[model samples]
Each structure stands twice: as C-alpha cells, then as structure tokens.
Target chain A: MTAVSKLLRRSETAVLAILIVVMLVIGVINPAFWQADNLFNLLRANVVIGIMALSVLTVMISGGIDVSFPAFAVAAMYLTVIAMNAAGYQGVVLPFIGATLIGLLCGLANAFFIHTFRMIPLIVTLGSASVVRGLLLGLVGTSIINIDRMPPSLIAFGSSTVDIGGSKLSLMIFIYLGIAVLMWLFLTRTMAGRAVFAYGDDAESAKRVGFNTRRTVYLVYGLAGALAGFAGLLHSSMIWLANPRDFVGYELDVIAAVVLGGASIFGGRGSVFGTILGVFMLTLIKNSLIIMRIDNTWQGVVVGCVIVIATALTAWRDRKALV
Target chain B: MNKLTDFRRFVNRDNNIVQLLVITAIIFLLMSALEPHKFLRYYNFESISFIFPELGIVAIAMMLAMLTGGIDLSVIGIANLAGILAGVFFTRLYPAGPDAGAAAELMRVAAGVVLALGVGLLAGTLNGLLIAKVKITPILATLGTGQIFTGFCMVLTGGPAIVGFPAWWGFIGNGKILGVAVPLILFLVVAVLIAVMLTKTPFGLNLFLIGTNPRAAVFAGLRTERMVLYSYMLSGTLAALAGIVLSGRTNAAKSDYGTSYLLQAVLISVLGGTNPAGGKGTVLGVSIAVIALMLLASGFQMMRFSNHLIDFIWGGFLLLVMVINVLRNRGR
Candidate 1:
C-alpha cells in the first residue's frame, strides 16, 4: 500500500494518468484515433516536438530557460538547407553536420552572453531569439525553400516507412525515441549530468562541490542547441519545406509541454520520462482538438489554460506537502 | 572630498540621460546626412510624434511592472483587447449611421473609452490575482495569460480588423492641439502623472520596497500583495490607454496589430535604464529613451533598411547595453 501510494504521489504519475484518460477519451470519440496507421502517423508527427522538449528539459533542469531554441533551430536549418541546395551536397550526413555545427556556434554565443554578463537567461534568450530571427529575415528575406529539391536519399529517409504486419511507421519515430533514450542515459549515468542537477539545485553549493559550473552551463545549452538543430532537420523532412517563420511561435507550446511533464520551472527537477510524457500529452491534446473539429485559432487558449492550471496545481501540491 | 562627491553624484544621476542624448544626436546627424530634405521637415517630426507615443506609453507600462520586480508580457495583449473591445462598443453603440448626432458621438466615444479602460483593469486584476494569490511565478503566469488574451482577441475579431469608427474619434489619434499632436500631449500628461505617483506616493515607495526586498517589506508591515495588485492593475490600465489611442489612430482594431510592439516596449524600458530585477527606473529616463529609439528607427526607415534589420539592431543594442552595464559594475 505504501509503495502504491508512493508511486501515485509522483507528479509524473498524475500526468501519465491524465494523458491516458485523454487518449482513451479521444479514442472513444474518434475510433480512427486507435487505428494502427493513425497511431504510427501520430508518433511520426510528434517526433520533432518530442526532440525539442528533451532539449528544453535539459536547460530547465540546469536552472535555465532557452526561448531561443526555435530561432537557433530555424537559423541553423535554413542556412544548411540553403547551402546544401547551392553546393548540391546530396548526402544526409553533411546537412546534419552543418546544422549541428551552426547550432553549436549559436549555442556558444548564448553561453558567452550568459557567462559574461550573468543576465537572466529568459531575457538573454529573448534577445538572442530576436537577433537570430532578424538575421534570418534580413538575409533570407522570408522565402520558403522547398526541400523536395534536395537529395533523394535524405527525402527517402524522411519519408521512408516500414511495414509491420499491418501498421506502417516512419523512420523519424525511431530517431526521436533513440535520442530520448540516449538523453535518459546521460542524465542518469554521467557525472556531468549529476553536476547539472546540482547546479540547478544550488549554484553556489555546486561550485563549492568543485563542479565546473561554467562548463556545465555551456554543455547544457550547447546540447540543447544541437538537439534543436537536429530537430530542425527532422522538421524540414516532415514538412518538406524550410521556411524561416515556420517554427517561430511554438516556444510557448514546447515550454508548456516540458512544464507539464513535471519539470519545475524553478529548476533541478525533471526526468526524461516525464518530458516524453509531457510531449505526448500536448500532441494528444492537439490531435484530439483537431478530431473534435475545434478551430485552429482557439488552440492557444487551450494550451495556455493547461499550462496555468498545471503549474497552479503543482504549486498547490507543493504547498500542501510543506504543511 | 566634497568636489569628488559632487562629481560622482553627477555621474550617477545623468548616466542614462546622457546616453540617451548622445544616441539621439547620432541618429539625428545620420538622418540629416542621409535624408537631408525629408528628415528635417516639420511634418516628419509631427508624424514621429504620432508614432512614438503609442510605443512610449506601452514602454512606460512595462517599466512600471519591472519596477515591481515582475514583467507584464500581457501588456500588448491587453492593449489589443482594449482596442478590440472599444471597437466593438463603437460599432455596436454608434452603428455608423447618418442620424447620429454630436451628442450621440460624444456618448459613443465616451462609452468606448470607459469600456476599454475597464477591460484593461479587469485583465490587470486577473494578472494580479494569479501572481499574488496563486503564487505562480510572474513570468510564467503573465506568459500564459498573454497567450490566452491574444487568443481571446482573435476569437472576438474573427481574425479581421474592425473599422469604421466615428469621425470625431480621429481627434485623439491625429488631431493637433495648438500645433502639438494630441497623442503626444496625452503621453506627456500620462508621463507626468505616473512620474508624480512613482516618486511621491506611499504606494510607489512600497512597490519599490517589495521589489528590492519582499521579506523586508512584509516584516515592515507593508501590504505587499495589495501593492503588487495595484502595480499590475496600473500597468494594465496604461496599456489599455495606449491601445485606445493606437486603435483610434489606425482607425481599426485587430488582434495582430502592433504585434511587434511587445519587443519594442521591453527594449525601450531596458534601454531607459530600468532594472529588469526591479526597484529602479524613471519616467523621464524612459521617455528620453523612447525618443532616442524612435529617432533611430526613423533614421533606419529613411535609409531603406528593412524592418527585420531594425529588429536585429534593437536586439544587438539590448545585449550591448547589458554587456556595458556588467563591465561597469565589475570595474566599480
């Protein structure tokens, strides 16, 4: 009984329960939601968001928020796509490498500003997001380039599906799941990962404990930027277009997903399982809303309300625990 | 020793104001050299006057929230909603008919203003309640509310701008009073009133105290929660006023109108030397900073720079200023 209570007490348990209920409800309303084909498609659709949520989880776990992820991702992906088309670089590896490198450079810049000035991450990321977006707009001129013109191998990889008895699954699902498992391992097994949690819990104490706080900050933010870049590649593959404005306003949704996954915004509290669940929950909400025939315009309302309510409930539960 | 003290005081007091003046001068000179004919004209300055006040008022609203150690990202949302609600009132109450008299026009405009401002207050109160009562982090709370407010604005207007306001409504936006733009006049009045309240009122002092040291304020018997509510409520009302003027000037109300103003307002507030962590800012400083930015923006536009380039410059400038600030503090 005590073990059951302990499991139930975990915040992620509540989120998992909520997600299951939502999925069941949606399945009941639209029987097609449970179809194997639709389920696989849903998993493919959520890969990019799932990847980005992991990146956000890393930063949030290390006591920071990076709203600049979308901007960095868009900038890196756009540049790579533009360059690949210009140079006629056909292979998938080169584009991924280029995007990750650009993302790393941008991440280093973010780290430089945060380390040197010690400004609030929120404000710094906000500024950096604008700068990157503005640079893209100024240089690229808001043009949407079609990735369909790219190498056939990359497009095939993006669109390729495998048959399993009767259900087809896109290659992107395995990629996202692979990344999530790696992140989970890193967070649980590595000393550097432990340092990230300590830094988030108490920066000064982490420093006192002889952790290289600066390097941790750099690694955390750089990893996030790199993952975002990878996600950008996947996103372009999924959409078959590299538009500068494609992913600009979805930071809030991504942040909402991470927070819903039981990561405290205050820091030092989150898990890979929780983050994946959070991503799934948001994707479920979005898919269910569409199945319900709700207007696309009202989507923000639902997401915003969910974020506020979830955070409020967490705060209440924490307070109750204190008493 | 006395002379050194006086010099230090001057350095501390005139720092941001001096920065503002120098940036403004550089922009003015650049514009003069680039667009000698058009930039020097009286009409150009008048047009700038109309444009700057809407941005300036919103910046001031942001400044007030920052002074309370919180940010109100919902200012733009509130501004848009206020304008939308007022637009609704104008279209519904007046109906844009020929039989409407001067008296009806007056009533229509009056009702519109009141309703818009009232909605602004309600939005602010909601923010206050969430932040103070629910104990949610201010940034997250406001971010969520801002999204919801923007969604509401979109749902209300059905994604199209509401237009056809009364003819007299133009007076608030475009009219000249003794050769001064009405919006500029209103901006100054609001600035003065806010300046006085910030400097002279007990409420204002309590706000600063709460921001700088909430525990100290609470231990000193301050009603910290109520003061926080009051601060956000004031911010909301100011955003609403800006919205009214903005919608009136544009002669339309839309959810996405002035979407860019969000970043601009935060840029202006910070450029004006308002501390993001709160407890330090000045109306005069913010007003001067607004002008400096407006001049820069006008000069950039005249040079045929794209709006995107201007945004890049603003973002770069924000980072540069903080770098300088941090360096200066370290040196001290």
Candidate 2:
C-alpha cells in the first residue's frame, strides 16, 4: 500500500489529527484553555475515564462490548472500601485484590452468559449492568462511603504526586499512563493480544485456526472487569467518597470515548492509542464546553452529536475501504 | 392415537405463547395466594389496569423495531419530546382562561393530540432516515438522537416540567369510558392495530423476510431500506402516543420523565416474545408479556418491596427469559 493510504488507514493518525484540530479551535476560542494548570486538571479529572476507555477498547477489539464496566467498578470499589472500613486493613494490595476479584466474578458472569446462550454481548451486558447496579443499591442502599479514616497509604496514593515544573500532578496520572503503556504492549506484542484480534475478526475462523475463542472471550472480559475495578479504587480515592450513584451512567461516556477513539462497535478494530485519544477528545470537549460558558444542559447535546458524527464518519470510511 | 397426536400438536405449537401463559398463571396464582386480601380486589385490579398502557404502548412500538432486528432506544426521548411539544402548543395556542368555553377546551385537546403525534412521526422519521439512509447502527444512532431530542426538550422547558393543562386533559389518563380506563382502551386499540399490521398485511410479511435475510429480501425485490424506515417511524409514533398518556396522567411535561421506562420498554418487548435479533415476534406475545410484568411489578410494589429489588427482578427476569428461550429453541 502507498504510504499515504497506509497513514490514512491508521485510526490513531485520524484521531490525532482530529484532536489537534479540536485543541487548536478551543485554544483559539479561549487561550486560557491552553494553560498548563487547566490542562493538568483536565487530565486529572479524566484519569478514570481514560483508564476505563482502554479496558473498553480491549474488550471491543476482542469482539464484545461490556456495558457493565461501571457496575463492576462501583461494586468492586464499594466492596473494597466497605471491607477496609470494617476490617481496618491498612495495605492497598488487599483492597486492590478484593476489588479485582469482584470484577473477575462480574466479568465471568458476563462471559458465562454470553457463551452459554450464544446471546449478543450487548444484550447480555445490558442485563448484567442493571443486575449489578441494582445489587449495589439494594444491598448497600444510598449510603455514602467516606475515606477520611482510611490508612495513610491509601491517602498517599490518591493525593501524592511529583512536582512537574511547579505543577501539582496527582499520582493517578502515572497509574493511568502506566496502564496504557502496558496495555499497548499487551495488545500489540503478545500472542494473546493477537488472538484477541483474531477472535474479534471472526470467531469461527479463529476457532478453526486453533485459537481458544471462548477462553479468549473470558480473559478479555475478565481483564476488563479487573482494570475497571482498579480504576474504581483510584476513583474513590481521588473523590474521597463513594456514593452509590457514582459511576451509574458513566458507562455511556466510556463507550462514547472508545467509539470516538476509532474503535468499531463491530469489533476487531481498535487500539490503546486510539482509546487514549478518544478519552482526551471527549474530556477536552467537556472542558471546552465549560470554558466556552455553554450551559450544562447542552453538554449532552454536544457529546451525543460528536459520538454520532464520529461513528458515522467511521462507518463511511469503512464502506469506502470496502469499495 | 389421534387424541395423543392432537395433544402433541397443542403442546408443540408456539412455545412462547405456552411459556407466557404458564408464566401468567403462576404469577396470578402466586399473587392471589400471597395477597389474598388485596390482590383479588377490584380496586387493585383497576389501579394496575390504569397504570398499564403507557408502558404497554411503548413496548409494542419497540416490538415493531425488534421485528426488523433493530431497537429504538429513542422511544423515551421521542415520547418525552412529543409530550413537551404538545404541551407547548396547547398552552400557547389556547391559554387557560377563567371563562373558557367547552369549545375552547375541545380545541385545546385536539390540538395537543395532533401536535404530539406529529412530533412523534417527525422524530421517528429522523431515526429511520439515520439508520436506513445514513447507515449508522441503531444503538448509536438512537443513542445520539435520543440525546438530541431530550436536549431539545430541556431547552424548551429549561429543566423543569411544563405544567398547567386544561381540566379535561386528564380524562384520557384517569377517566373511564364505559367502565374501562381510557388509557387501557387506547392501549387496546394500538395493540390491535399492530397485531393486524404484523400478521394480516403484506408489509408485515416483507418485514419478517427482510429481517430474516436482508440480502435475500433484496434479491427478492423488497425495498429493505424503506421497510426499516417505516418500522422505526411506526415505533416512534407509538412511543409518542405513550408519552401523551404519561403527560396527561402526571399533568406535566418533563424531559426526564419516565427515564426508567426506556429499559422497562425493552424488557416488556423482550418479555412479550419479541426477538432481539429480529424476524420473529408477535404483538399478542408482547401484550401478554406486558401484563405479566405489570402484575409482577404491582404485586412486588404492594408487598412493599424496594424499587431496587424490583429493578433487580426486572433485569434478572430478562436474563432468565433469554436463557429459557435459548434452551427451548435448542430442544426444538
């Protein structure tokens, strides 16, 4: 293929170009938007979304959509916090393990249902989303979790950061970046990662090629659940309180970002880089809307329009490629 | 041998109808047993019947879209928007006056219904165009348009409900006609219309063919795109009708009203035996499913069950039904 065609084909390139254009427009509209402090704040605010976007990207690339991530994250985070408060556990590893385990179970349930029934992943995840959210509310009610009494290690993780040119950066940024980098390696360089793409591309063919599609499906969903769990822990730490309503409707945001990042909802097409850009693009749109003094009610309008347009553009591009 | 063969045919015909009937029986018996004092009362039944149609109409609308292997998540959005539009037109065109005559009131009601239905048709047509013409996936397209519609409604009302309807406006929602609730009658009319459309018409036959195999349908000279568009339009209009019932009953028009109904609509449609994958469902199946769910929901509410638990049950019930359907299909 020609270099121009190859470059145009890469989702990351297209996303990066769009990101630049958006940034340029926003910066032109309000130079204050380009301020380092504001930029850092935006990244800090979107750390959870950024992290969750990667998990979604991976799952989507593996040929499934998990709308239950928010539910998994909230449930895991709540369980961890409740456990720590009740048992007085100090170390972070215990809580992380606890959260990840819950995520694993939720993911397993998702995979089990999808595989056994041969049902659409979207429908299965949709049902599971409610079940988990309902369980959260039914079992825990509307209680708010306060982390004021948590161990110092937990506090440090949420609050501590290195001085980067006299700017306050939360430790969560590094965690987010670290996970993205690792995910990049896993998706691009590992056999399992290749298998994920293969399975997503065509499950029947992947099975014929000796790839264990079902196991891959389980692992992908389980890993997504685990990452969501970790992200939830970080989220609760950053916010210092876990309300039951927290993260309830944020799955749509995550899905939108991932889709914007150039991941086809049809699966077998997405990247970690694209997801990061997608998250950044969405976060930037949100921040820009605030900067431009747009009413909060219009935020949905802007985001929804962007999602639809982005998907439409992607669909058009796919059709063109086929032609 | 003839009697045994006849019994086998009865058992084997339409598993879903049988399953729905058996489920209805079980829930009825259970509710009767548990709430022996209240369940069988005419008042309780009336209350259940009163609240049934707003959701039932929307579910039937969703069933049409599902029959074409697509879903209309925009139902709630369109419903709310339609109500809001009707509200806007009604209040603006015929402001409430102290000495307004019956003629003015009749005009206001007629205007509201026409405006609401027109808005529903327009919104649904947009959805159909986007999905069929633009080739966007139903989930994302509806998701986006749902936002847009809701956003427009928000801009119209500025986040609060629009109130102040004529005194007679609530008749359709709360009044009874010949010993039957007006909304129930409306629901029945809608259900019958959809039933006839799906089973007794060539359009419905082609819809099933298109859903089952798009390429085959295309080869057979069916206008698949138009079929999908019409299906969505029909779904949208029905949802809007539901919105009218909702607004009338509550005496307000709000963008966020019945947010829960989005999922409940999908649940009801699925429970009614509408296939999510398309090409297989019936209006009768959906109506029966809605009744079953409403019964369960009311029973649970009467027992003072938490709303969260009810949500849990709804979600779990959806999953359970799908699983059973899978097993039954496999057995066949």
Candidate 3:
C-alpha cells in the first residue's frame, strides 16, 4: 500500500493519469480516434517531436534551455540533402552521420558561448538560432527538395515498417522508442548524467564536488544537437521533402512538452518517462483535435491553456510544499 | 585635470549610450558614403520615421520586461490582437455611408482605439498574473500567453487580413504634425516619459532593485509582485500602441502581421545594452540602437540585398555584439 501510494504521488503518475483521462475523453467523443491506423499515425507523428523532446529533456535537466535545436535540425536536414544530391551519395548511414555532426558543431558553438562567457543559455541559443536559420536561408538556399530529388534510399528507409498485430508501424517510431530507452538508462545509470542533474540542482555545489562542469555542458548540448539533427533528417524522410523552413515554430511545442512532462523550468527535476508521457499527451491533443471536431483555430488556445494550468498547478504545489 | 576626469567619468558611466552613438554615426556615415543620393534622401528619412516608431516602441517594451529579469514573448501577439480587435470593432460598428457624421466616426474610432489598448492591457495583465501570482517562470508564462493571444487572433480573423479601418485612423500611422511624423512624435514622447520614469521614479528604482536581486528586494520590503505586474501591464500597453501604429500604417491587421518584428525587437533591446538578466537598460541606448540597425537595413535595401541576407546580417550583428560585450566586461 505504501509503495502504491508513493507511486501515485509521483509527478509522472499524475501526468499518466491525466493523459489517460484525456485519451478516453477524446475516444468517447470520436470513435475514429480509437482506430488502429489513427493510433499508429499518432505514434508516427510522435517520432520527430518525441526525439526533440528527449533532447530538450537533457538540456532542461542540465539547467539550460535550447531554442536553437529546431534551427540546427532544419539546417542539418536541408544541408545534408543538398550534399547528398551534390555527391550522388544515397546511403542512409553517411547522411545521418553528416547531419548529426553538423548539429554537434552548432551545439558546440552554443556551449562555447555559454560556458566561456557564462552567458545565459536562452540568449546565446536565441542568437545562434537566428544565425543558423538566416545562414541556411540566405546563403545555402531557400528552395525545397521535392520527392524526386530526395535520395531513394532515404525515402525507402523512411517507408520501412514493422508489422505489429498486422498493423504497419513506421520503423522510425521504434528508433524513437529505442533512443528514449537509451536516454533513460544514461540519465539514471551514468555518473555523467548524475553530474548533469547535480549541475542543474546547484552549479556551484556541483563544481565544488569536482564535476567537470564544462564537459557536462558540452555533452548535454552536443547530445541535444545531435538528436535534433537526427530527428530533423527523420522528419524530412517521413514527409519526403526537405524544406529549409520546416520546424519554424516547433521550439515552443517541444519546450512545452518537456515542461508538461513534469520538468521544472528552473531545472534539476524531471524524468524521461514523464517527458515521454508529456510528448504523447501533447501529440494526442494536437492530433486528435480534428477528430474531436473542434475548430482548428482553437488548437493554440487549448495548448496554451493546458500549459498555463499545468505550470500553475506545479507552482502552487511547490509553494505549498515550502509552506 | 579635474574637468577631464569628470568628462571621463561621464563617458564611463554612460558607456553603452556612447558606444551606440558611435555605432549609429558610423552606420550613418557608411550609408551616406555608399549611396549618397538614395540613402540621404529626405523621403527615405521620412518613411523610416514612420516605420521605426512601432519597432522602437516594441523594443522599449521588451526592455521594460527585461528590466524585471523577465521577458514578454507575447508582445507581438498582444500587438496583433490589439490591432485586430480594433479593426474588428471599426468594421462592425462604423458605418460606411454619406449619412454618417464626422463626429460619430471620430467617436467610433476612439472607441476602437480604447478597445485595442484594453486588449493589450488585459493580455499583459494576464501575463503579469501568471508570472507574479501563479509564480510561473516568466519566459514559459509569456510563451503560453503569447500563444493564447495569437490563438484568439486566429479565431477572430479566421486567416485573412482584417481591413476597412476608418480613414481618420490612418493619421496615427502616417499623419504629420508640424512637419514631423505623428508616430515619430508619439515615439519621442513615450521615450522621454519612460526614460524619466525609469530613472526618476520609485517604481522604476524598485523594478531595477527587484531585478538585481529578488530576495534582497523582498527582504527590503518591496512588493515585487505588484511591481512586476505593473511593468508587464505597461509593456502590454506599449505593445498595443505599436499595434495601433502598425494597423494604421498598413490600413489592415492580420494574425501573422509583423511576425518578424518579434525577433528584431529582442535583438534591438539587447543590442541597445539592456541586460537580459535584468536590472539595467536605458531609452537612449535602445533608441540609438534601433536607428543604427534601421540605417544598416535601409543601406542594404539600397544595395539591393535580399531580405534573407539582411536577416543574416542582423543575426551576425547580434553575435558580434555579444562577443564585444563579453570582451569589454572582461577588460573592465
């Protein structure tokens, strides 16, 4: 009973309970929401954003917020496609690797500015986001790569599916899940991960305790960039197009998801499981609004309300605990 | 020797303003030298005067919010919603007929302006309440509220531009008084009021103290919450003023209008020497920074550079400023 009560008290449990309630409500309103194909589609939709949320989770856990990952992702995906077309390289691995490295370099730029200058991560990332996006659109090219120009191997890889109960699920969904599991392990089982949490809780104490704060910052941001790059490429593949303007407004959505998952905006408090649940909850709401026959225009308002209420509740709870 | 030292102290104290003035001068000289005829035109300056005020106002609003160690990401949303609501008001009630009297038209436009400013105040108050009362982080709260405001805009407009504002309303955006643009005059008045308020008033001092150290401010018996709420409300009103200027200038409002201004506002505020962490900024520095960037932008326009390239340059300029500020701080 005590164990069950403790489980019930966990933040992730609250998110899970709320998510289930939301899903049931949506399902009751629209039976089509329960369709296997629609559910699979929701899972597939989760792949890109889910991966991005994991990246954000890492950054949030390390006492930093990155609004630049979307820009990095789009830039990597666009540039990789351009390079593939230029070199006539069709292999999946090389392109993915290239995109990840590009993202890492961009992430390193953020780390360098933030760590060296001790600048606020938000402003540094904002500056870098603009620079990367402007460079991508201005110098590289603003044109879209159509399906005809997209590498056949990449498209094929994107289309590959796994059979589950005779319903086809995109292979990318599995990859997303795999990445999430790996992230959970790394965050829980690794010393470096503990250092990230330590730094987030109190940077000065973490430093006094002999953690390599610089390396942790780099690792956290670098991994985030690499994941964002991978997700960007995956997004393009799934959509079967490479547009420089893709993910123009995804930063907020990803951040909102991470925060919704019970992560403190101030850092040092969140879980991988909660983040996954948060992403799913958000994805479900966004994907099912049409099915629920709600006006599409209300989407932003609904999401905004959810964010405010959730954060306010958490704030109130924290204040209560202090009292 | 004493006079020289006094002058030096003055220069050091207002270092950001001095640097911005030098940058502004350099930009002005470069633009004039590069395209003497096009860049130095009387019409060019006039057009910029009309346009820069809206942006300048929004930047100042951003500065105020940053002064509290907070940010208002919803400024653009508030601006657009204010304009759209006013536009909706004008379209709904103000009749377009020969029978309509000038007084009635003026009254209607006045009501519409109030409604717009009211929307700004309400939206800003909501942001303030969320941050101060609910105790949510400022950035996240503003981000959420910005979306809500934008969503309301979408609901009202349903994806098309709202047009048909009264003819008299255009004066707010484009009219001239004493050979000076009305918007420019409004901007000047606002700049002076805010500068005085920031430097000369207890509210302003309290804000700076709160931003510098919230715990200390509280310990000193300051009502930090109320001050933050008022600052956000003021910021919201300023944003609405920008919205009025914008819709007036264009004679239309839309959900996505001035989307690019959001980034530019943040950039200009920081470039103007407002510390993002809060507690320090000035109207003069922000004003000069806006002018410098505007000059640079107009010069690039003269050179026939693409808008994308201009955006790239702006981003590069922000990074350069960041690096310079860091180096300067370290030197100090």
| Fnat of candidates, each listed | 0.54, 0.50, 0.55
Error of 1 at A241 (Å): 0.7
Given the true complex, what DockQ would model 2 score?
0.59
Worst 10 residues of 2 chain A by lDDT: A314-323
CA shift of A274, model 1, Å: 1.2
DockQ of each: 0.60, 0.59, 0.62
Q: Which tens-of-lDDT digit does each residue in A1-323 have in candidate 3? A: 69999999888999999999999999899989888889999999999999999999999989899999999999999999999999999799999999999999999889998898888888888888888998899899989999999999999999999888878989898899999999999999999999999999889999999999999999999999999999999999999999999998799899999988998877788899999999998899888889999999988888888888888877876674321
Query: lDDT of each prediction vs. the true structure?
Result: 0.85, 0.85, 0.91
**Chain A TM-score across all models, in listed order:** 0.95, 0.95, 0.97
Q: Write the per-residue lDDT of candidate 2 for residues A66-158, one digit (tens) a residue.
A: 888998899888878878887877787778878888888898888889887898787788788788888888877668866665555677678
Instruction: Give stretches of model 1 more than 4 Å off.
Output: A147-151, A318-323, B1-10, B92-94
lDDT of 3 at B18: 89
Return the lDDT, model 1, position B218.
84
State every prediction's TM-score relative to the real structure.
0.95, 0.95, 0.97
The TM-score leader among the candidates is 3
Q: What is the lDDT of candidate 1?
A: 0.85
Instruction: Quote the positional error of residue B195 for candidate 3 in Å.
Output: 1.2
Over A1-323, each residue of candidate 1 has an lDDT whose tens digit, in order, gives 69999999888899999988988888888888888887887787789999999999999998888888899899988888888788887778878888888888887788888877898787788888889988899878688887656555557668878898678888888889899999999998999999989998888999999999999989988998899888887788677778888786678889888988998777788999999999888887876687767877787678778888877876676554321
**Number of the top-ranking candidate, with DockQ as the measure:** 3
